[model samples]
Target: MQASNSPSLTRSQLATELGVSVFTLNQWAVSGKGPKAIRVGRQSVYRREDIDAYKATISSTESTPAPVSQPIGSYMMRLPEVLSLSGLSKSSIYAMSKAGEFPASVKLGSRAVGWPSHMVMQWLNDRMGNVA
Candidate 1:
């Protein structure tokens, strides 16, 4: 791991900067599609230069950078918002999640949980048949 004083972005920070989800970053890391990260104890951190290089490579191949899928505030949604968006009640949501029919909630604390907005949106999009 690089020195803590060195410039680096934690996985969550990089996900925010790149307008993606931490879950997405994890998938990218596993598939070797995202910027290289250094393991720092139990967490991963991306060096500033590595992120810049990754951005450059992406820009070179794509006409334009990808747009942010969701607003910063909506990156994670509490139960209520998820319920409203999906038009499902709390019990139904929990049931569906348990059955693998819904995106599972991320644990925010001992009693708090949230769903990644991107995943929920993707699920909705899939159900809607990619409707605009």
Candidate 2:
């Protein structure tokens, strides 16, 4: 992770890294939902270090997020990628998604779509809670 003194990143870049819309991240800034951003003249930027710090904060605050080796909010993933990461069959994933038992996918194009890696992670955490 870069330090607080690292170079800055545009909002678009951060949005891609976190698998969220730029508009959503902008909302986070306005609503104080995500990490604090740096303002360079008329642009909003953030340091890599700040993002890492924010992840650390989230990880620490979560009490019992499943038993996964890593937090869900760390990366973006596609459907096939998610299947591999989760070890769930494709049919099960679709059923879960329809039942709101999983995160919804975001449309990338007319035919292409993807889900945020973190949402899948959160869903996994939620599943762990249902274990009997």
| Candidate that would win on lDDT | 1
lDDT (Cα, tens digit) per residue for candidate 2, span 1-132? 333345766888788777799999989999998777999899999887788888799888978657545363465577899898778898988798889877877778898878778788777787778784
Q: Compared with the true structure, what per-residue lDDT tens digits does model 1 show for residues 35-97? A: 999999999999989998999998888786587475565688899899889999999999999
User: Candidate 1 versus the native: TM-score?
Assistant: 0.44
TM-score of each: 0.44, 0.42
Q: Model 2, which residues run further than 4 Å from truth?
A: 1-6, 63-132
Question: Among all windows of ten consecutive residues in candidate 1, which has the lowest summed lDDT?
Answer: 1-10
